[model samples]
Target: MINLYPVLKPFLMAVEPEAAHRAALGLLKSGLAPRYRHDDAALRCEVFGHVFANPLGLAAGFDKDAEVIAPMLRMGFGFVEAGTVTPLAQEGNPAPRLFRDVKNKSIINRLGFPGRGLEYFVAQVSDFRVAQGAGAAADGMLGINIGINKETASAFEDYSRCLSALAPMADYIVVNVSSPNTPGLRDLQSENMLDALLAGLMAVLNSLDIPPVARPVLLLKVAPDLTSDQRAAVAQLALRHHIGGLVVSNTTVARPEMLAPHLREEAGGLSGALLKDHACAVLGDFYRLTDGRLPLIGVGGISSAEDAWQRIRAGASLVQVYTGLIYEGPALVPDILRGLTARVRAAGMAHISEAVGADIDLAAPRAEAAA
Candidate 1:
């Protein structure tokens, strides 16, 4: 597909980031966005019991309300995770919350969980599944990422409500306790808090009327800012709770020294090229902590297939992108897929899964020392 982003980037850059996002969503929903499809035996893989067309996904913030899953899937993402959807509709932070660092190819967003609420989100997803008839699985997997409202009295109440409503429609459900924009949300990542939260959420998952085999896989989206102790604690808690996977990670609040000084001061999570190294380091931490027992979806800088490949070797079963899209456009999806296919062949692997964690040795003395 011809990339129009180069032509459109100037115009999009002139508009407010959030407004441009909304317009892009509107265009996608109207079927005006370019569509690209990629299917390669070498790039296919299964994670959390579902087979994906590829290992590349569009990360959560891009389609915050499940508005364009089909369109995004058509654009060649192996999967599309929608929302950081709250239990109630929220206006999010305020204007000027999303800022661009063009030179660094990064973004800073304090747009805390702004969405149309669970009811509207569920309806859109349900309609998408219905429209796909019996062939929904062929279109690509759908992951619904749910989060609590800003003023939620109980995170469990808000989370369980979203889980109950969206699980039936989701191939996997991401409990997002890591968005820095939401006050007190990151606190949920604390060991005690996360343990209790996971216990409560697992109870809710078990109680659901859905059959165990058909139940949506439960995953957690975490931040990249955890202390070493916090990371170890999280890994232990996740393993103990039998959570299906972890998205490592959400955006980071820690500003990189390389970021433009003005953009670095933005009060929000940072993502994109500036975040690449730290996110990968955090991802490697989780992989070692979990000992590759849990599937990890790596996000936070992946604009190229090389980035995705590095993530896989570092133990990401799948990789995702959002801020990268702002710079590269939809053509990035196919480009990454083609590159991955080549990498798999170069590595003499028949399938992408063979390369997952190829660089990690759980038995290494260093890993044991760290443990």
Candidate 2:
């Protein structure tokens, strides 16, 4: 399709970042977002018992309240993850929470979880599903990401309640314990807390009224900031609880030295090109830690197909992007998939999955020089 992001970037950049975000969503919901259909065989892949048209997805935070999911899917993402929704609606931090670092092609956001909450989110998805019919659901998957309210009395209980309330509408339920904007939220990633959280969520899944055939897949979204021991602990806990998958990372609290001086100091999660290496390393670590048995959806940098392919080779079964969309526009999806198809062909593989982790060692870290 025509690339409009470049022509629109100057205008988009002039607006406040958060307002620009909402404006873009407005365009999407208004039936004005770019749309393209890609039926290339090489891009098709499957995981978590579902067939994905491609392995690339629109990560959480971009469509936080389930708005524009169908429009986003039509833009060619294999799936779209919506929300970091809490039990009740929250305004999140204050204004000037989302900042863009144009030079570094990154974003630092302390927007917290400014969303309409579970009741509205679930209703929107339920209504959208019915309006679109089977064609929409068959077109792409919708992954619902849930988190706790900033002031909730019990984080674990909020997660269970949200999952229980939204399971029927969710293709998958993501337990978000790693967003740094929520105070003490990242602390939920601690071994004991995460173990208890996942166990409780699994129990919620078992207790859901939905039939087994309609049960949503369970996945964990984690932060890139973790020590080796912590990563191993989280991986083990995930396997122990039979979690369906893991979104290899959220965004990092660590600021890269190279980020522009003005943008580096923002007190929120850092994402985009600045995040590429660290996110891949974390994905590789989890891949090796789990021996590639656990499916991972890598997110963080991923601005191009090379980035996506590298993460897959490092061990991500699927990948997601958000900041890349801001920088590269709607054309990014088809571009990456096209390049990925070429890479798969060059590697002499019939399918993209065949190349996953092919260049990495399970016992050691792959050096930067190796790639």
| Model 1 C-alpha lDDT per residue in residues 1-371, reported as the tens digit of each score | 76787888788889988888988898888987787878697888889999998999999989988889998988889899999899899999878799899999999999988899999999999888997776752389999999999998888999999999988889999999999998999999998899999999999998999987789989999999998888889999999999999999899898778889888667999999999988887888788889999999999998999999999998899999999998888889888999999999998888888888887777774444342
Q: Which window of 10 residues has the lowest lDDT sum in candidate 1? A: 362-371
- Model 2 weakest lDDT span, ten residues long: 362-371
Give per-residue lDDT, candidate 1, residue 229.
85
For candidate 2, lDDT tens digit of each residue in 318-337?
99999999999999989998
Residue 331 lDDT in candidate 2:
91
Q: Identify the candidate with maximal TM-score.
A: 1
* Candidate 2: clashing pairs of residues: none
Taking all chains together, each candidate's TM-score versus the true structure is: 0.97, 0.96
Per-residue error for 89 in candidate 1, Å, reads 0.5
